[model samples]
Target: MSATSVPRARRRSAAPPSVDGWELFAPGIRGEGTAARRAWRSRYVRQSAILDAAAAAIAGFAGYYLWFVVFAAYGPRPPLWAVLVFPVVWVPVMLVARAYEERFLWIGVEEYRRVLNAAVLVLALVATVSWGLRLDVARGLVVVTLPLATLLTVSGRLAHRHWLRRARQRGEHLQTTILVGSRETVAALDEQLQRTPEQGYKVIGCCLPSRERSTGADAFNGLPVLGGVTDVVDVVHRFEVDTVAVLPGPEIHGSVLRRLGWQLEDTDAELLLAPAVTDVVGPRVHIRPVAGLPLLHMERPELTGVRRWTKELVDRSAAAMGLLLLSPVLLAIAVAVCLDSRGPVFFRQERVGRCGETFTMLKFRSMVQGAPKLVEDLTRADEGNGVLFKMRHDPRVTRVGRTLRRYSLDELPQLINVLRGDMSLVGPRPPLAKEVEKYGLDMHRRFLVKPGLTGLWQVSGRSDLSWDDSVRIDVRYVENWSLTFDVMILWKTVGAVLRGSGAY
Candidate 1:
């Protein structure tokens, strides 16, 4: 008998084994059951609330001191009671905004977005109450408190998310998951989950379609094939699964899925439905209920329009401001580069931009003189993800160049590219002319937007990513480009550059 095969008599039974008392409890509540299945989620949520409250209190008091005690010493000040009540109001507002929900936590921009929205709402409420009651609320206090509260709250959430990600990476606080779908779909989802362990999914097994289950086969993609589609609940019980992710397919649909949801309710396991769509994000995907059925609606990618125009405006403005602010640093780096290497301070190369337009991309020179001429001799030593030439310790790099590359100081000149509208602050990686020549039809999607100074590629794995992974990330960015997404990438870029793991 196969390892996944159930006995013939047991397979014939429609009713499953009686649910244990521990499995009957609500989500986020601890029960007497498997040690691994304890409710870490409840503790995490409680910790988040405490952190948010603490952040709000600190922001409120700090804002009060800055506005009333220091800056506006002689000006009319709000009562101390108002400052004390600020956190009391702020925490409830965030709760109402669903900022602490598990779905929005540990991943995505939704959590931060909600926090900002809650801050805005609180500001509006404060304004309305002050006007209606003729209260002596200082405008400065309101202005400082709300923004500070939002910032501190977001920072707190980020810290929590970082801690959670670190824990997940170490194989702690992970959701033991089971993939339910055809072998092909299950394998694909498993591959993606494996790539992002911080997402907290640990796929222990899979359940293939009944007809597709091989008699002798017990494993797929290094994961044990637990059973057929019908065996999901049994497998969940036997393994004490935390999550069951069902991929879209014909084998599991209509009443079968509805019944599966009903069955899962009797246990602690949560059901997840993975749409067939790939590379699309939450903002573009919406669910519409029509005729009493939930229908997944996908919005077209925003390639152009007001949002794109706003993005372009912000990119150039930010680049110009960045150049102005970092001028001293840039000049110092230029002098150091010229002193350390007998070459021009700036390196200019032709790179493909939006709509296949060629532009002169600028970078603070990080390679020895005539480095391009040495490419042929060093081709055999290339450790890059093919198509690009990368060497961990390239002989062509100067002493100062290595440090510049490590901290990404070499890319500072790309601000000029952004100012010239040849690149964006955040977008796809700027591909070389030679690299663009090898592009496939799907890869051309990256040209839909201006190449970026820092992007998903830079923050993700940079030079360490495989060629396919690089292309996939770039194309995905193009497909799901948004202002929020860009900000998130820029934020992550700071940490990525600081760690400097994948930089060559």
Candidate 2:
């Protein structure tokens, strides 16, 4: 049945009750819709305040004891009032820094960044006051307390986030969302929200433009098509939506958006507009108001300069230290590989690196000596996403090889590559020469940075990712490379390796 042929009554029934009736009869429904979200937000904020206060208190007391009691001879004793008042001051400082804002809570790196910024501000204020007043402030106490507080606060937030994620996974705490856009844009936004359920967006339905609405189709991408764009306010009231996400498109322009915002003013649902740009977030994009209009200003990615040099220095230093510290484990893996297989303990394969340069990537030999030769015979059994060859249980894997691969012990030799500048501590996965040969134009963007010992690809399902997904992640990492991002991936890599999923 075509959309035009659909009965008028059926279309009206598909939409919510008339706006006037819903408003007059269901005034209390608005409060019920937002109660859960408001409650969750309040609870989270309260918990965060408690955690921050406790962290500050612990650091303050511990620092005072260590400085005045243990190292009493080295510095003048500070007054006990300073220690007692630290938590009182710290929580307000965090509030001033916007650390506990609802927007920053439970998601994104911004929360952690705000916490760190607040800690720094507190330390600076303390140091300046002490110096200006000529007070006998113990340098040791100042040094230890601020850092300890920051660490404790961040740790607490991380644990809280983990708990929240578990809750979201169980469908306990989630924003009831209604997506408004063209079907294509709605589906895309829905897919992303579905992909990261921990972000806490639970899309209940979508509102499409009248022209975009299908005739007989009542659902799209498994979500019901609630109504047309004009029906958004009624749909929100009827469904008790906590969030209404509008995707940018021709049908929903400035005037239409303004009207929608005005209509939602009396309701509890928050409005969110998703710009067309994708995979570009954080500091790269900023909103600049010019000529009374807010315009998005995107800065070019910084692929080089002081930050890049700093990253290189940190990578080399970390790689050198890691190689030194893990020498025993490396030795053990080497011995095991040698005893279990006739091949050399190390496997060196030519891999494409930064700027399409070639390097010999090293790994503990986890396959038979003649495994490369067997590729043709086993092509039919390839389990990879086409670009790479992967087999969960290959015949070529030695007894010890399976264990090494499972735990990613075989990749330990890549530390030498990192130290040698052939790779980074975290970067795009190094592509094999054959894999690079099959690359399209955009895929070459992966070579913009050095390959990694472990990267977004490594931690994000590794071999289980489709070829397109692998490429997309690599390019995203290249375009948004940051020291913090590298650290995040490295941290997640530890957990991924322990879980041992998708690491054949």
Candidate 3:
């Protein structure tokens, strides 16, 4: 305080940051670490249970099937030499096929493929060893067991998958999910959560960005947006938030968000970026690291190689099978149609199929004889994606037509279109010529593959989907075409048809 002496400038200490009660912010009313531990425990417990059941099933089947093959081949254990085949050859084949892998145990199509691979590989090894050793392996036994066991194993796995799916529906085992985003983002996330309940993302709360006015204490969609960007680390530690979905927005600065992500490194929490890129799939997004920046690159649709072969095969096989199987049904429908409507059994409409090609797509006449003339009058009443004309209860529909349209039975005649190679078992649903005319350049890619009898649009809420949603699904399909994907979509189509969802 001496005037002559320079007053020592008082060095100010930084104020200590305020902290919320850890218990209040804990995830699911449990302490943060405890909640995480519980979640981890639950996951392993469920997995172990599944693994135990799978192991038992595989072991039992493998043992019995081996016995049957051995007995039938060499008649009640011919020699130690013959018996040696089971362990050396068969077991290795099973392992190579990944029959014991958890991924294929209850998986669809992959399970079937694994079973086939296991059987074929085992049999091949058996043959090779038999030939090399000059041992007569009974051809009859191999022939009978190969296809039969493969079918049985696949069937068994399918049955188990059904039970597992049902158990999940009943909420036997579910994973907890903590969403961190705005109300709209959380709500959108919740919608996806509803659809895939089996994935078991139990939304604990949507952690909101902090408020400037007061301490962060708020809820979005009944789930707490417990804290904001600044307090995220604390929120994670406090809430035991397992999955932190950083929903992209303006309020959270990119650099600050990056720092928060870095802080998450030490925690057990998984950080997920919920990019606003809706409907686009993983195969499309390529991440390019430019200096320190992560650039997201979307590749244009490429249809080539095995995809072309698979598409060709699927189109041929499915179309042929559909035509043959539906022939009788088509005949019956034809008779009914002729009787009820006094019009041609088949309605041929000039629809735009793959690559701007004009195809007379076949359909069971769902409208009156002169229905095309009525388009002008119905134009104003269009309920379709603006470009397409549709009515939930079109007045032009015949009595038989109404029934056909209800279950998408009218579209059944597209099997003929399929057989003609103008359609596929799975592709974008063909657009009408008028609809195609209105399409932007992006929409044109949908025509790259043969149009389908049933497609993403059909199974994914159909008429209920917005134009953008429909377009996106179509585009996604074009960009990510695969035989396995096509089969899955076709399988879902059966359920969708049975439910009559979104079909008018």
Candidate 4:
């Protein structure tokens, strides 16, 4: 439908029900309209409240059991009043901390952060009460219970989010979204939403900035043009949208946006300002108010610091321990490799490392002897991207090599590379000389950190990723490298390796 066809909202004299201080009712929408919208407004809110209450009860019980039955730390037994008051205190505190708020519940780390904050607040409250009343308390038990309660609470929340994510994949419980920006921005936003429906946004249509005047295009990038920027309230009423995403563009200025916020102040539709800077995660961006204006401060990544040394230490230590612990498996694999083929057990290749340096990357041989010599003959049969040679049914792969490659046992020897500082446990993939030579200026950012045996590339799709996608993810990793991010990648790598979707 064109923007001009959207029905205008009927202005009402009486007030509508407020949502988080904004009016949520579409005045003209009748029948079961306002009541139905009001009911859904608190759907996730109530869900979160019930889940948090259950988490609090479970954590409280576990904490009490651990303190009294297991540890017996509070002089013969803990106080009954203290045990009973925990869940009572915890749940109310969580509610007060805004942990059950709809905005942060299942979307991002903010939910986890709120849970942690509530845990800390509970601990502080208990400590203050104990000291003030001069009550005999077990410090060790308190320590144990605090962390235990926190862990349980966060885990419960994660489980809920997992369930929600699965439901969202089935196209349920999604926010009907409308984009308010230029055609290009709206189209771009739509593509991202489609790629990750688990984000809970379903873009039904879009409103162009030129809605005040006529835009030549009726539909854009497969989405219906609902109306112009000025027609947002009318469009919201027309479609009964749940979210209004305002992308960065010339048509939506500061004054224009303030007016929109005021207009939306009486509607349940959420106003989201999506900045133009894309692919930037939360850790890299900070907002601060200076002289009554919110200023965005972009933090450049910190690649060198004590944290970097800590990561290196962890890499080397883990590599050494892994080699020792898995020696039996390693020996069995080596024997298997040797028995499967006549050539040496190990294969080494020259790969481009950080800053264009060359290093010998080790792996169990996953191909027949003289495989390099056969590459020229099989060039016509290559099913891989032009830069990297790969084929699902490569003739050069031996029977055992295929099995080893399928499960990534062939890459186990790269632990040595990690120990030697030629690679990291998590980073961008090490590129071959031929591939590195094809890199553009932006692609060169991948070299800022050492390559890895398993990284964004390995976990994301391995050999299935296109050259552009490979470069995009690799550069993103290099620009946003952190210890926590590396650890997350390492954890996710286990599942990716198990699935082995893109492995040849």
Candidate 5:
């Protein structure tokens, strides 16, 4: 062979050619540093600080007042040293409880639980110390302080919560988040955020993971697609993203995911995982380390023994007491319905109850005498779907019926259903026989327990919720059934009824 025809051994390139190519494109790509971006970043920072200070101030004041109570009851207040040290202990406890976390600050049971636990611990320690020191402390002082501190601190947080909620309504101080996922998943998530922007996540852009390059013009609900999955890290940096939600998808690999997590370290942006479990509650998920791998254990929700008895007792007691306490209201409603329409004071409907058992569920009549048969005539005009039949403004509704439905007073007679053991104070809302007939297999799982007078559906968004969302909430409640959760739902139910939120 000629010398010119002989091939020379080639040396490897010092760096990958891809790196050089990327370098050329890097400077031309713009990131999230526009004026709106800077404003959003600053607003979140300011909000965080304000909320933190609010938490600290409330906690501190509570601690001091509690100390004062014990001091006053003992005939002489504690020395300045004890008073100063009291708030010190409270601050750490509050921080540990993450009372400063924004999500728990507004009308959540978490905040109250933390506050109560911390207060009880602090007071218990003080009592022990007083006994050890032989300092005379009166019980009244402790008792008085408990109520005083709890009242003041809770009231303060509530006031702050109101202010923050109003601020959100005016479109001030919200976290700008970038969702990274497949086109379909991100699009669905973007829809939720768009509908409820007041929940406080502003979608800046979508980082869609596609096999092919995504045009920056591609949009989900009008939000731009900044780049494809391969450009996620770059997009994060470019967008100055406060939060990155890795929504449900199979495109991301474990190694690539770990790399993404590593890249997020020390960045101001928060990394959130939106696992594919659509109807799971937080309490049911437990993580345990096994053989160097973190495994999540999901406990089956079973109501038996104490839990069953507790629920039954709660149902009976609450129903009995409610019937007695609301007797006057019931009487008034009965009179109003009688005077406003020809319908009976009470309406009786065949409903599917526990374990697919059919029973008569009683409620104060909220419509004209023969409304059920009218449902057939209105089928084409039905504003609801699947098992629900809702009309925002139904013609069959009497003047009194509208008021009764709006405040949920019509459902008060379900207390009788609870007494008969066909219903619960809290569970899935009872379904009509016709509705139950349409149940798919998964839908029947709701009947494992007795139907409820009020439930996750009632407390969440009631008539306003879509069938899917309602079913998801019910499934979550059933899967994560706990006494604590039941208590919380009942508490929320009160607020829902009072606010007339998601009612007729």
Candidate 6:
């Protein structure tokens, strides 16, 4: 064997699993000691620190510059020192808000929550201070800064996440993990970790229960068997593992978990339990310890209420303003479609809407005249999921139609639909009358809300989604509808459309 490969190979075979119960197949201990791990982890942390401070400082300075200098709003200016001092004030506010908490960094929406929370508190504090201390600051500056600061921070976070994901994809700054659960569960969990390598998990080995260890296997689903479940502590120390992922199974009971957590208190390894229930995001799932049992409380589905009304108000207002602002672009598209294809400038199709109602959805014509008649001929060669027809290079799409569809310009007419209350700015994609006919009972849940101009389907692969995935995404959207969720989807939609991903 080659010299480098020999050392790694020898380490993997160095010792048998402990007689007590866990396996220890970690090669990382010898190659990557605690010092090495510290060096590797600090790279991302340093990058995050720099970006966080820059975003806050930029937002603070820009807000002051725009209101006091550019527009020169008609109001008494605060002391000149305040402009210079603004960013410095926000840095502490963010620190107090726990904006850079290590647990929240590079994962979850909690980071975004903290950043925005800091912005809100800062604004409220400034208003109170200005009024109470006779500082007479213009109200307009406060108003502009709230959104500007929050937006800039969110932007910086997204860029950092993208950069970190690329780094993780290359196998950098990954947390070493050891799986502790049933062979079956560990195998399944291994698949999950592999599927999302961007999460930066490096599953080095596994610890199976005693009953399942007699299989005479060196590995479980390609992950080395470190030792028996009882040897979790030894294996963790030996590997210097950063995380011990305990998958769902009867073997890892509450007492065992508590003890494991206690033992790991002195070690760097963190014990993470993978709950049996999956696909439920943090917003819907809550934990409350009632009588010592960590009972998971599931929030009821938000089908309609004040939140829905607020969404409706925002949708209509934005749509009306969008139509007025984009009138020139819309007119240009209509003229271009007219010149490219022998079809009406616009195409209207009957689609299933909220509560099983039907409405005419509008779009610029991106197909030849009477394209519906060609569906029968193209049925055998349809590229889309069986229910929704999509063609990446359909002969019926004109040159201009192709260009329009690429960037979603064909969807501009849907702003009118949004204004008319027949659709939302974000929701499930409207199904055709024929497509709805194929609906099973579960599929009907998508009609619980207004059809969307662009939705989970649009931003998450659009025409590329499988039939099952399309239904799943739409149902998930219905069950977890929220204004915040809608805003996030809309923001992602811009990047999705810009890349022309999954658009026909």
State the lDDT of candidate 5 residue by residue for 1-504, as single tens digits.
221222222212333223223322223222433344346434543554454345445544554556565343335655544434434565566667665555565544677777677677767776898889997764554565455655555666666666766776666656667888887777667666664656667766677767623443354445566777667778767656677888766677667678889888857667877766556665677788989877777777776788899899989998999999989988998898899978689999888888888998898888888898898888777666345778888889989888888889899999988987989988998887876666666677887787788888888788777666666677777877888788878988888988997787
Counting clashing residue pairs in each candidate, in order, gives: 0, 1, 3, 4, 1, 7
Off by over 4 Å in 6: 1-30, 33-43, 47-93, 116-155, 178-196, 203-240, 385-389, 433-442
lDDT of 2 by residue, 1-504 (tens): 221222221111234434334432223434555786668888999999999999999999988987778777475676877797889989999999999899999888899999999988998898899889988777788888889999999999999999999998986677778899998899778767866788888777788888877575666666677789999999887878889999987789999999999999989889999989777777798999999999998888888999999999999999899999999999988888888869799999999999999999999999999789999999989987766788888999988989988999999999999999999999988888887778877688888889999999988889887776677688889778888888889899999999998988
Candidate 6 displacement at residue 32 in angstroms: 3.5
Locate the minimum summed-lDDT window of 10 residues in model 3: 3-12
Q: Return model 6's CA RMSD, one decimal.
A: 8.0
For lDDT, candidate 1 versus 3, the one ahead is: 1
Per-residue lDDT of model 3, residues 1-504, tens digit only = 111122212211223122343233332344335344445444543553454334434444454456566554445435434433443444445667776665454434565676677777767776888899998765655665455545555565666667666766776444445776666776667666666666545556566655521554344444555566677778777756666777866666678778878999988777778777655664667799989788777776557777687678768887788778778888898889999967788888888888789889888898889899998998878776554567887899999888888888889878778777888878898877777766777788897888888888898888866665677678878887777678889899999998987787
Error of 5 at 235 (Å): 0.6
List of clashing residue pairs for candidate 3: 27-239, 208-225, 210-228
TM-score of each candidate structure, all chains considered together: 0.85, 0.88, 0.68, 0.86, 0.79, 0.77
lDDT of 6 by residue, 120-233 (tens): 888889988978998877777767766776788788888888888999898777778889999878876776676578998888888999888898687656567888878999
Per-residue accuracy of model 1 over 10-52 as CA lDDT, tens digit each? 1111322222322222233223343455477778899999998
* TM-score head-to-head 2 vs 3, winner: 2
lDDT for predicted candidate 2 compared with the true structure: 0.84
Runs off by more than 4 Å, candidate 5:
1-89, 92-117, 124-140, 146-151, 158-162, 191-198, 212-217, 220-223
Candidate 2 clashes between residue pairs 3 or more apart in a chain or in different chains: 3-215
- C-alpha lDDT of residue 151 in model 3: 57
TM-score of 3: 0.68
Best by TM-score: 2
